[model samples]
Target: MSASPAVKALGWRTPLLVIIAGCTIALLNFGVRSGFGLFLEPISIANGWGREVFAFGIAIQTVLWGFGQPFAGAIADRYGSARVLAVGALLYAAGVALTAYAATPLMLNLTLGVLLGMGLAGTSFTVALAAIARMVSPERRSWALGLGTAAGSMGQFLMVPLSQGFIAAWGWQFALLLLSLFALAIIPLSSALAGKAPEGTGPKQSMGEALKEAGNQKSYWLLISGFFVCGFHVSFIQTHLPAYIVDRGLDPQTGAWALALVGLANVVGSYTAGVLGGKRSKKYLLSFIYAARAVVIAVFVMMPMTQVSVLIFAFCMGLLWLSTVPLTSGLVAQIFGPRYMATLFGIVFFSHQVGGFLGVWLGGRLFDASGSYDVVWWISTGLAIFAAIVHWPIDERPLVRVAPAAVAAE
Candidate 1:
C-alpha cells in the first residue's frame, strides 16, 4: 500500500488513530524489553558468568533508559515525538542486534545496557503517552493513558512466550536478532505521533520556567518519590523473578508463565485505574495501590512456592502491577496540564529509573553476596508503605492559574 492510503486509514492526527498507533508502539517497545529476564539464566550459563553479570547489564540498561528519557521527552515536547522515536527505534534495533554477539560483560553493558537504554528512553511510555495526552482532550486523556499502559502490559504477556519460543527454536542470540526486527517497526508507527504539543493560551513558559514551576510544587516531589518505589518493585521483580523461581525449586517455565500472568492481569488493573482516575481522587488511589502492593508482596513471599501459588501471586500482582502508571502520569498531566506532560512526567519517570537501577543492581549484588532475595523483598515491602504514606498528603487539585479578579468575573 502507498503511504498516502495508510496515512488516510490511520487518519493521521485523529484521536482514535493516535491512540491505536500509540498503543501499538507501547506494546512493541514494552513487550520486547519485558522478556529480557528470560535470557538471564541462559546467557549467564553460556558465558559461565554469575547472575550478577547479566543482572548488572540489565540494571545499566534500566538506569540509562531512565536517565535518557527526560532529554527525550524534552526534545519531543519542544520539537516533536516522531523524530525522537525514529532515532530510538534505530538505537533499540542496534542494541538488540549487537547484543547477540556480546561475549563479555563490558560488551553486554554497552550493547544491551547503554544502547538499549537510550533506545528505550526515546521510544518509551513517556513519549507515547505524552503524544496521546496532546492528541486527545482532557476528558479522554486518563483512559487513553490507561489503554496505552495496558497495551504495554499485553505486550509483556504475549512477548514473554514468544521470546521463550525464540530461545527454544533458535538460540538466544537469534531470538534477540528477531526481536530487533520488532524494534524497527516502531520507526513507522511513530509517524502518527508526529507534531509538537499544542500550546495553550496561558503566558508562554520556557522549559526552565516549567521545571521551576513543578519544582516548587511539593506534590510533584512526592510523586517523584512514590514513583521511585514503583520502579523498585517492578524492576526487581521483572529482572529477577524467573531466577528466583528456579532458585525456589520450581520449573523455570513457571517463572515465564508467572510473568505472563502479571502482564495479563495488569490489563484489567491499568484500564480500571484509568477509568477510576477520571472520577476518584488520584492521590487516594495511588495511596491504595502502594499499600496494596505491600500487602500482596508480604503475602506472596510468605506463601509456599508451587505452580498454583505462583500463578495466583502473579495474577494478584498483575492487577496491581501497572495500575500505578496511568494514575501517576494522569496526576502529572492533571496538576501541570498537558502542554509539558512529556517533560514533567519524564522527570517523575527518572526517579523510577533510579529505583530500577537500585532494584536490579541490588538484586544481583545482594543475591550474589547473600544467596537470597529475602532482603530485597523486605525492602520492596517497606518502600511500598513509604510510597503509600507520601502520596497520602499530595495536593491533587489543579493549580489556580487564573487571577482572583478573573475568577470573580467568571
Candidate 2:
C-alpha cells in the first residue's frame, strides 16, 4: 500500500520518536538496577541481617529476572511495549514499596526477587531494544541499539548520586520510594511507544516456539555461555564494589563515585561500540572487549589499593562495561531475525542472570566464610578471558536459514 501523505511527511519523526522512547525506557529500568548496590549496607544493617541475606534477595532477583524476561518479551512482542511497560511500572512500584518495609528474608526475597525481577523483565532494555529494532532499518539498528544502551548507562550516571543523596537525607526506605516514583514515570513515556499494526500480517510466533528455536541454535548456546561470564563479572562488581572499598578502608563515598564514573564513561563506550559494531564484525569486537576487561582487572588487582588506582580502574573498567550488550544483542538479531528478537534475547539474558545470581550470592557467602573476595575476583578475571577466547570465531551470519519449510511451519 502507498504511504499516506501525512505519514510520508513525517518520515524521520517515527524513527526519532521510537529512539527517544527506547532511550527513556532504558534509562528508567537500568538506573534503578544500577543503584541496588547503594542499598546493600544500609538495608542489611537496619534489618540486622547478614550481608548474605540481602545478597540472597539480589540473587533471587537476578535469577527470577532471567526467568521472567522471555515471557515478558513475548508479551511485548505479541501485545506491544506500552502494555508490557505499564504493567512493569506498576509491579516495580509495588515491589519497591514493599521492599521498604521488608523485615524478613522471605519478604525481601518476594519483593526483590519475584516482583522487582519480573518488573525489570517487562520494562528493561530487552523489550525496549526489540521495539527500536523493529522500528529502524537494518543498517541503523546497531547504532540505534548502542544509543539505547548508552542511555541506560546515562541513567546509571544520573541515579547513583541521586540515590546516595536520598539515602543520606531521607533514608533507604524513602530513597526506594523516590525511585518507585521514577519507575512510575515510565507510564507516560510508554505512550510514545504506542502504535497501530502494519497492514495485513500473518500470525506471530508463539513464545514457546521462539524459546524452542533458541534452544536448538548452537550459536545461541555460545551466546548464552559468553553472556554468563558477563553477568558474573557485572553483578559481582556492581553488587560488591562498595563493600569491597569499605572493607579496604576507603570511604564509602568513593565507591559510589566509582560506580557513577563507570556509568558516565560507559555512555561513551557503548555509543562508540555501537557505531563500530555496525561497521565491523560485532563478534570480534565483543571478544576484544572481553579480553580487554581481563587485562584491566589483572592490572587493577596488581596495583596498590589506593584512591587514585581505584578511580583509574573504575574508569578503564567502565569503558569496557556494557560494550558487550550491543554486539550480543546484534548477534541475536542477526542469527534469529527480529521477528522474535525480544523473546530470543530474553532466553540469552536468562543465562546472564543465572551467572549474576551466582556471582552476587557467592561474593557475599565467600566474604563471610573466608573474610576475603580474592577468590571470586580471580575467578571473574579468568572467566572474562575465557569468554573473550570463546567469541573469536563466531560466524556473524544467520545460523538457521529460513527456507520454504520454515516459512510454511511458521
lDDT by residue (242-315, candidate 1, tens digit) is: 99999999987899999999999999999999999998998999999999999999998999889888998899
Of the candidates shown, which would achieve the greatest lDDT relative to the real structure?
A: 1
Query: Could you tell me how far off, in angstroms, the CA of residue 323 lies in candidate 2 after the best superposition?
Result: 0.9
lDDT to native, each model: 0.92, 0.85
Off by over 4 Å in 1: 1-11, 402-410
Candidate 2's C-alpha runs over 4 A off are 1-13, 195-212, 399-410
What is the C-alpha lDDT profile of model 2 across 77-116, one tens digit per residue? 7777888888988998788778998999999999977899
C-alpha lDDT of candidate 2 relative to the true structure: 0.85
What TM-score would each prediction reach against the true structure? Answer: 0.95, 0.93
lDDT over C-alpha atoms for residue 164 of model 1: 87
